[model samples]
Target: MGSSSLRVYGGVAGNDRKAERRAQLIEAGLELLGTGDGEQGVTVRGVCKRSGLTARYFYESFADRDELAVAVFDHVVSGIATATLEAVDSAPAGTRAKVRAGLATIVRTVAEDPRRGRLLFSPALSSTVLAHRRVESTRMFARLLGGQVREHYGIGGSTALDLMTEFLVGGLAQALTSWLNGVLDLSEEGLVEHCLEMFLAVQGGRLEPGDGAAGLQAGTG
Candidate 1:
């Protein structure tokens, strides 16, 4: 019984170590991928070096650098989504306040971590896997936006609502990318305020329907 228990404990320790190493590799990938040094920096050797692990350990967690990149991208996206949701939920009970809180969280998150912004927005850094993941993330956010529209306003599901949500998500992504790249020329506060205005307009029924403006107005108004 003692020998059996020892083996079980050893196995559990081994598994824990493996999980820790895997998490380390993923963090290294994020560091490399989010760098201004660009995609060229995101090599197996570079990630392993950044992770303080050898090449052999890299293979234990990932088949190749691309797999690691995809994993990092997913990790970053999940973090952003969680932050946004938490901000909105914690805000005072008002549509405008919730919108402001949610938008501010997203802007601040990317602003504080420019690498994260690059990972989400940089065309030069995109891979096939990352691109596919981006689309999936956008669709997921759109669905959430649709639900918010329904709840915040008395609107039901419709094609117009779907399109409006998609448009809002896409436009926000582009806006953030431009802001991150220094093309938008706005301070973080300015950016959040600007986005809030558009969101408020939508909620207030300023945009027209089927055309992408209509549903937002109905939902928010």
Candidate 2:
């Protein structure tokens, strides 16, 4: 079947069905990414097979594997971002508490499926793929952290916020990589607790022993 017969999601007549199918394909791609090694996670063929949809459907919504990968990346990032925001935004009572909540949400979500976590942060993906994703992911991180910092601590307007956001994202990315590789032996709760500790220390809310986040604020600010 051609792209015409394959249907475009959310575009026009018969679009709802196509949109639903597209959502399923993206979901299937994420699941495949979960089960496979981080290295082989979610190829186009794998997504088609897992989604039980025709390859034509894939091309109908995506120009190529890299395009499909970008779609999947966006979908997954949106989910994680939503959950993380919710976790952080709910009445945390203080800046430190909210920051801890935010860190907890991030580490727990990534720890749940490390392969997808790795894929989200992989810099080696195609430039076209990486460009679209970097913008989306960076914006998501920036929006959440910027809002939280301003609301909880009176920080404003993309100065320290940018540095802090980069620190949080880069730190979490490295932590996820280490955990997935078995170098970091931390349970979800332990991950959340330890990560929050370092995050707070680095955020300048505390100065304690073993806080790898020391000097992070000065460097970023």
Candidate 3:
């Protein structure tokens, strides 16, 4: 809050340098948390080393490893959420169209960089700090889903909407985790199509079973 924090050195503002260092630290944290077994294996020294910064710089950015882990988690989640929201908003009106657009964004975003997926759902990274961040992201996504359904259906709040969003969010986390880990055995588009068809059968209009499966088989065959 003082001019000292705003002071410039070597043509770079102090605040700018601090932000760059913070970003570097967050990226370092992401690498550690995403690749390691869990937070137990992560250390401040490890992150500092990875970022090529010293302990003082690490302390300037994060209080501890836990805070860094949460920051890393949030960085990934915010990116995916922003891109998906843009895709969904730009898509044609209607639940199926909007959700399919959003689904493609989410799938492609993670598939392009699977470290993002592992950081989000891999059991290996489920430390207390990340677990809480995971819950927050889940609920946040649930709210987004619920808001979408409401917009598409022109309906008010309801318990059914809340339950459906929770179901969709949980199901997505599990399904995408499997896909990312190779357990789902579906290509990126196949996974997106499958989810678009199966995940919202509760809407109950034209989402017959095998809708996506038939398409997937044909595309693969």
Q: Considering every candidate listed, which one attains the maximal TM-score?
A: 3
Q: Rate the local accuracy (lDDT) of all candidates.
A: 0.82, 0.68, 0.83
Angstrom error of the Cα, residue 69, model 2: value is 0.2
Q: Rank the candidates by lDDT, best first.
A: 3, 1, 2
Which residue segments of model 3 deviate by more than 4 Å?
A: 1-5, 206-221
lDDT of 3 by residue, 60-97 (tens): 97888888888889999999999999999999966778
Candidate 3: which pairs clash?
Answer: none
- For candidate 1, the clash count comes to 6
Off by over 4 Å in 1: 1-12, 205-221
User: How many clashing pairs per prediction, in order?
Assistant: 6, 0, 0
- Error at 152, model 3, angstroms: 2.3
Q: How far off is residue 109 in model 1, in Å?
A: 0.6
- Every model: Cα RMSD to truth: 5.0, 6.4, 7.5
lDDT of candidate 2 over 55-87, digit per residue (tens): 888877878766666777887788888888898
Model 3 residue 184 CA deviation (Å) reads: 1.0
